[model samples]
Target: MNESNRKRGVLSPCAACKLLRRRCAQDCVFAPYFPAEEPHKFANIHRVFGASNVSKMLQELPEHQREDAVSSMVYEANARVRDPVYGCVGAISSLQQQIDLLQTQLALAQAEVVHLRVRQNASYSSSNSHGGFYAASPSNSGSPPTTLPASSRGKAIYNMDMVFDQANMGYPIW
Candidate 1:
C-alpha cells in the first residue's frame, strides 16, 4: 500500500475531525477494541477530567477491583495515621516512666538529706548539753550552745522543699 493509505497510528474515531470537514483519522488502538456495550468517551474526553467523574469511573470498575482499590487506599491512610498515634503513645509512656524513675530518685535523696540533718542536730545537741536532751540548756562549759534557731530550721526545710520540688518537676530524659 502507498504511504497515504498506510495508517500512521492506532485507529479510533475522531469526531472533531468528522465535524470539521476533514478525515476522522482513527487513533488510540484501545478505542476500537472497546465493546459497544460499554459506555463511550467517559465524561466527554474532550473536556478536562473532574475528580467526581473520575470517582464515578472507579465506582463503575469491576466489584473485586474496586473493592481492592478502596481497601488498599483505606488501609494505607489508616496505617499512616495509626503509626504516628502508636509512636506518640509509646513516646508518652517512655516519658512517664522516666518521670517516675526521677521522682523515686528525688525521694531517696530527700530522705538522705533529712537523715543527715537529724544526725547533725543530734551530734550538736549531745556535744553542747551536759546530757540534757535540749540544746538550749546551759552546760558546765558555760559557753552559749551552737544550735539552729526555729526560724533557721523553718528556712532550711523551706529550701529543701524548693529543691526537691524543682527536681521533681524536671524535664524527661529522653
Candidate 2:
C-alpha cells in the first residue's frame, strides 16, 4: 500500500507467484517460506512437486509443521533434480562409502604402528649394543658399559611409549 512497497518494489513476488505468473495474495502461503531472490529453490520444488499438490500439502499441515515440511520438500526436490535415479539416497550412500574407506585406512595404520612398536621394543630388550630404535645412553654404550638404574630404564620405555602414542593417536596415552 505504501509507495515504496508498490508492484515489484523492494518486495519482489514470491517464487510461486513469479513462476505461476499471477498476483501473490497478501496472505500468500509461499511468501514466508520462499522469497523472490531464491527463484531457483522454488523452481526446483515446483518441478519435482507440482504447484497444486504443494499447495494442498501445505494446507493439510498445521501452522507449526509447515516450515519444516517446506524445507524437506525443497531438499528432496533439489536432490531429485541432481540425481533422478536415486536422489538423496545416492548422496548418503556415497558419503557412507567414503567413511567406511577412511575407517579401514585408520585401522590399518593403527595396526601397522602397533606391529612396529612391538618389534622395536623386542630389539630394545634383546640388544646389548646401543644401535637400536630405543637408543642406549652414550655412557652405557661406551667402554665401561654401566647398567642403567631401574627408574631410568622404566622412564625410557615410558617416554618411548608416550611418543608412539602421541604420534599415532594425536594425544598422550598416559
Candidate 3:
C-alpha cells in the first residue's frame, strides 16, 4: 500500500477495527480519531455509545467537527464509567457547593474586617479627644461611620452591606 493508505490503516487495522475484529478500510471513519495505539479510547466509547451509533454520529458530522465530537464522547464515556448515574453533573455540583461555602466564609471575613476598622477609628478619635472616653459625635451616633481617615479616603473600601445583600440574592461575589 502507499504512504497515505498505510497511515489510514489499510495495512494495519485501526483501534476500532481491531477491537471490533474487522478490517480497517481506507475510508474508515474511526481511523483518524481512534488510532491503533490507543485501543482503550475506542473501547470505552464503544462500551458506552456502541460502535454503530458512533459510526453514524461521526458520519453525520462534518469532517472538521469529528475530532471535537470524538473528544467529547471520550470525556463523557470516562465520566459515565466513573459515575453511572450523575456523571459530569455530580462533579459540577460538588464544585458549586465548594464555591458557595467559600463565598459565605469570605463574606463573614469581610464583615469582621469592616467591624474592626470601625472600632479602630472610634478608639483613635476618642483617645485623641476627650481623655480616653468615647463621646459619640452628632454625625457618628446611631450609625456606622461613613467617612474613612484621610490616608484611607482615596482607597476603595469594601462595602460589606452590598456584599451581604448580593450573597442573600444568590449571586456569586467573585
Best by lDDT: 3
Give the candidates in order of lDDT, highest first. 3, 2, 1
Candidate 3 Cα deviation (angstroms), residue 53: 0.9
Error of model 3, residue 50, in angstroms: 0.7
Error of 1 at 133 (Å): 15
Candidate 1, 72-163: lDDT as tens digits: 44344344354545544565677899999998787667766765565555556676555645444332134443577767553454254434
- Model 1 weakest 10-residue run by lDDT: 28-37
Please, what are the lDDT tens digits per residue for candidate 2 over residues 1-174? 422463435566788989989888767788778877778878988999999899999999998999999999999999999999899999999999999879767755665675555445445564555453344444224223334556656443322332233456554342
Best-first order by TM-score:
3, 2, 1
Across 68-146, the per-residue lDDT of candidate 3 in tens digits comes to: 9999999999888999898888888889999999988787777767656666566556645766554566434544334
| lDDT, candidate 2, at 101 | 78
Provide the TM-score for each candidate, comma-separated: 0.32, 0.67, 0.75
Q: What clash pairs does model 2 have? A: none
The parts of candidate 3 lying over 4 Å away from their true place are 1-11, 131-150, 153-156, 161-174
